[model samples]
Target: MNEILNNLLSLHSESEIAEFKEARNSFDFNKLGKYFSALSNEANLKKLKCAWLVFGVKDNRTVVGSQFRTNLQDLQSLKKEIADKTTSRLTFVDIHEIEHPDGRVLLFEIPAAPQGLPIAWDGHYYGRDGESLGPLNLEEIERIRRQNRASDWSAVTLPSASITDLEPAAIEQARENFFQKNPKLVQEAKQWDIATFLNKAKLTINGQITRAAILLLGKAESSHFLNPASATITWILKDRDGLERDYQHFGCPLLLGVDEVFHKIRPLKYRYMKEGTLFPEEVEQYDPYIIREALNNAIAHQDYELGGKITLVEFEDGRLCFSNVGQFIPGSVESVIQTDAPESRYRNRFLIDAMVNLNMIDTIGSGIRKMFLIQKKRFFPLPEYDLKDNRVQVTVIGRVVDMAYARKLAEYPNLTLEDILLLDRVQKRKPLTDDQAKYLKSLGLIEGRKPNFHISAQIANHSGERMQYIHNRALDDQYYKELILAYLEKFGTAKRVDINGLVLDKLPNVLDETQKYNKVKNLLQALKQKGLIESEGKSWRMSKKI
Candidate 1:
């Protein structure tokens, strides 16, 4: 019932917060309780909000049609059974029934264990070790217990930090940015001194310089105040081969360092002719706001405690990459886009607040989505975020990868940003959810099965992909069978190889040779079933009556 179920179903295999089971006909009730405990505890340790136990699916994630607890009342009763045995009377948050094309699916939403408390079933604590259920080990139990007690690294005050430790120019810039964001405060901002300005901008808390203050406004040499936590941003230029061509590093007063980094990379003008326009439009290689927002985001969200510096790489082509050392506080980029609100938790709460107050970044959580939208408007590839190994890496492309497809998507004003995003995946030949594939197919905007789709003629003409569409298009099976019949009538007898050779090139180019051969095989079977053709040994011939 939850939208997250769609994302989970798209997962190729079980995860710490998710499990799949066939459960066809029925399943043991106690096994469900054990899984509930395992998933809930695993979710907490992994810093996830909830876990899932999916029924009607196998270990390989195949939907084999589950019949477990078919009766609504019986399904409802299982909740009480689980609660009676769990450590905190914890049962499923909700049991959702989804009607999937393959079969009926049951999704059990299990809330993560409360902070500092490990979930248990019948007095035995449980957790997921990879994909298998097991006891919550002492180390893992302690990890969950320590989650809430962990201190905020960015909020700590540096005793030796003072107003002199901050760069005067950086402070002036912060004030100017603040005024620009709040034009009404112009005269009032001029009246206040440095201390008042710092406090008002949320850079310093009660005149005590915080780690955030030193990181953003402190002088270059003042970085030692946040010892072991590097207040550095590195910019590197790479050639086409990905070899480092040049590099520059900036430290402290990140407010100014952000600009220094921006200056190091060039944003050249690029020209492109639109599909329907006679004239060409010229735009900057990279949008300035996007560049600033990306750099500021890296500074605001970097895990400085890790002692790793934020890195920006500019490719010789037209791409920029920004990476910060830390797990994305929101867990997933999808959560950031879908929530569209300030996150409840942040790795650098104080730094983020200060940056927002200084107008360095937006606080409404729409910044990332806005970045995606801006690129979409420019008819360029959407920004790609790769979050893994406790790091968040984002890549922004300046030019269009497929000009026609990008233009087609840009011209469609009625399409929602989300729809455009999914369509972008279709154009790139990426995997799609079954529901997504079905919706696009119904609109005649896409063709082919999941994971291997092509833009359909309905939208391809506008995208300048009409020829591509024709090449990818599939004709009716009856037509292919008719072609086979005609071929046999002329040749009298033909080997399987001959039939394959005759039809392979006619099949959609989107399909591989194996798929093309398979298509011919299916057409041959259909012809034999209709008695229009008969196979003798390895060859096929027209039926005597026909």
Candidate 2:
């Protein structure tokens, strides 16, 4: 344990937690909140468990520790001050005191930023670029505040350098992709030299080379700009329960690493019903759209400023989890998918620029939104975000997940993205706010009392019987069509009352007496119009089409 602590001894850097170093050892209450918001949000973006604010540390990276104040009251005071300005009345877990053999350390372990809302510092939002905190640049701030965490990261480039240092192979690939994306550039493309093209591609810094230059074009061994932090993505295959089964790591030039990590991520064959039909159809376990967005977003948006690798975990039961080292810039997944707004900025401009030029991701703010759209079209559970320990974790269930649940969700097209995000929290067995629980109950998706929610049996298909679905479909307009056809083929309908009795149990799960009565009335009217079944006074009989 001490050995682990020994390695962590040199971990006073703000990049570790997304928190900033206070130029002055003493800062007031509002400033404390600002640091918490800055560090916590950045931690989530960086994908770390916690970002920290130490009382004593030299700019040179030495752990001098502090002597200003070490009393428990002072530590507790920090939490109260932050709570006043933040939503959810946030507070730190604890202000830690670590006495190294040489110096005394005060580690304020800030939690991850709250999901669905940006951590505003005293009514104003804040953000950090590297180590500096400003008014949280509007473009980048809005993108993250709305949960566009999957926005491009690689487009950000080091401003001081140009294209000369970029690798030739990566540049050549970029040019090919550019010509392919904009075919009109084909004739003019050949006319421009590499430098002119790189300039046009925004891969160069005013005709100079940048660290981003080395990252994308420099040899694998030439990545000195990102010292300590490796620009590598590691894929780990796992079983259904998340136990590791296999692993592989990938790195720049990103053009190759992106494809390498993708190949390593195992895709499974899957099947589902067509939107309006009830039948079997197949798609890759990992939606190609989802997989591409996730993989590219991880590369484009990762905070290489933090020294860690992006992780992709593929589970046997058909779930792929993509995580990277950085706080989720778009704050929460809910806001991103719900709002129709565009994201303004990214973390890795250089990397994202290259991907955009390479046709890997959209520079406009539609990445996560598109991911949500694809999942919804497939009737899949929405993606989830885990924001504890200062890191961001996104989990996408790839298989035909919970058919009944998917069907029930399809029934309610009005369900809000916020509600889905909250349900995701519940499914993970994480604590939900009272508002969240109330919302679930209102939708009849959950039952039972506080602390224990039994998914409504109707939606859960608790009996797990195909007959339950058969009966349930009898009452749905869409399902009614199928049943009318099925029932006529099985037992020629004789009495309207009999057909209602046959499907009464299914009605019990979904509706009250009035809804069931109305459903039966509607089905009878439709069958008669279709000339399949007609009512003779109070009785009904099937048409002798044969």
Candidate 3:
């Protein structure tokens, strides 16, 4: 710590990659976030591993004490707060607190912006012009964004590994899949040796094994060939409460491990009645194609350099979460779904190509969209994506979350995939942006205000969701007031508990217990304000005016 601080202090002034702040008592959070963005972007542009933001320091290199976030808990919480606002939730590598002879110094170690992604704070990109902080220029942003263009980690050759390092079984399976994919070359491929076949299949370069080969076909014991990068996939079976019931880790060759991981997941049967049929329809909890596509996509796009294993978590509630370490290259799932086209570029070009050639995945970039379509067709909730924390996680819900959503899909076979997606969000109670709300509202398919929307009455009637809609819909306040007045007239007086017992269950189910209580309180207050009811020592009675 002392060495690092001395080095920073040795600098005559703050550089592009370092900022000094004399937060003697406190510091503005917005300024701190801006510095995080600027320092991170500057570090990436300078090709440095990290940047520094030192507290309790002056621009002239004088050390003064800082009382910023004196509490350790509050100081540590800055990581999440910063991540909440920064692009990809990028945060400090580590925060170092130093007790210097001159004062208490704090060092915030900020990692460089990731390749292809410039750090943005609250939607604005920031950079450093010497010591001055400002918006990151277009050229600098493009320069950082273009860093990913030439890098292909999977295509890199591993001279240390050879055919002997790969599993014979996995290679044979690959040959079979490849033959199926390219039947015209079967006779020609059959005559070729394994080395020639591997080269033709794009798994190797000039008879030398590549990381893609190691990941897809390397022997389990040969995983060490990748060194620091992991060629592993972990499958965890969790109960409804999220407690791990069982777990198993499978290593390369991932081609065979995919099947092993798939079998570990129990895709139980899910039964739901068809729209009009009294009989229930039974289907596999998860579609086999969805499972393979998700797993293969994870393996194909995983940031192996991150040294994190791909994880597939199966919950007893009939959902599977497939996660891989890396950013979703296409940026957002909506872009992929909306465009329904191949991505312009990929992080693992070599690996993806090899997998596509083997028929393990499609190159059309419709895999995720296909997953959504399959879920929609089955009347199951669409797949959910959580693309944050420097990782891409996709959750496939096998069972139906809301019968109303499934019924809606079943009855309205003509509904566009986009409409189904927005409806899915409504069923999940996720917040909808203004445009989304406006579009849904314009279609007359939803009701209520932002964030508390419910299926409109017309759709609810046609979809057999009237009961659910009623539960979500609040009755008119006048009706509730009338009920209260009638109760007071019949009972003469009503205690708070009595009023709650009368009205709590009557309120819309969309409001939680707390909200229900608040609603009852508001109702009584409104009546009191109108002079229709009066409070008499913790009880209520009809007012003389009424």
Clashes of each: 0, 44, 0
Clashing residue pairs in candidate 3 (N, C-alpha, C atoms within 3 angstroms): none
List, residue by residue over 1-546, the lDDT tens digit for candidate 3.
899999999998999998999999999999999999999999988989899999999989899979999999999999999999998677898999999888999999999887777999999999988999999999999998787777888999987888999999999999999999999999999999999999999999988899999999999889888866789899998999999999999999999999998898885898885556722479898999999999999998887755678999998988899999888888899889999999998988999899988879988879889999999888889999999777999999998887777777777888898998998988888889999999999998889876678888888898777888898898998888899999999989999999999888888866768878988999999999988899999899999886
Native-to-model Cα distance after best TM-score fit, residue 187 in candidate 3, in Å: 1.4
Local accuracy by lDDT, each model: 0.83, 0.65, 0.89
The superposed Cα distance between candidate 2 and the true structure at residue 322, in angstroms, equals 1.2
Best-performing candidate as measured by lDDT = 3
TM-score of each: 0.65, 0.54, 0.78
Model 1 lDDT tens row, 1-546: 747667877897788889998899888877888899999998887778789999998888777778888999999888998988986466787899888888999999998876555777888888887898888899998987565447567788877779999999999999999998889999999999999998898888899899998999999989999876799899999988999999989998899999999988885987886555622488888999899988999888876644678999999889999998766778877778778898777767778888888889978889998998888778888888998655789999988787667667755757777777788887666789999888888877787765568877778776667787888888777788888888888889999988888888888877777778887888888888888889899999998867
lDDT of 2: 0.65
lDDT of 3 at 391: 92
Q: What lDDT does model 3 reach?
A: 0.89
In model 3, the Cα lDDT at residue 494 comes to 95
Locate the minimum summed-lDDT window of 10 residues in model 1. 273-282
By TM-score, the candidates rank as 3, 1, 2
Models ranked on lDDT: 3, 1, 2
**Two-way TM-score contest, 1 vs 2, winner:** 1
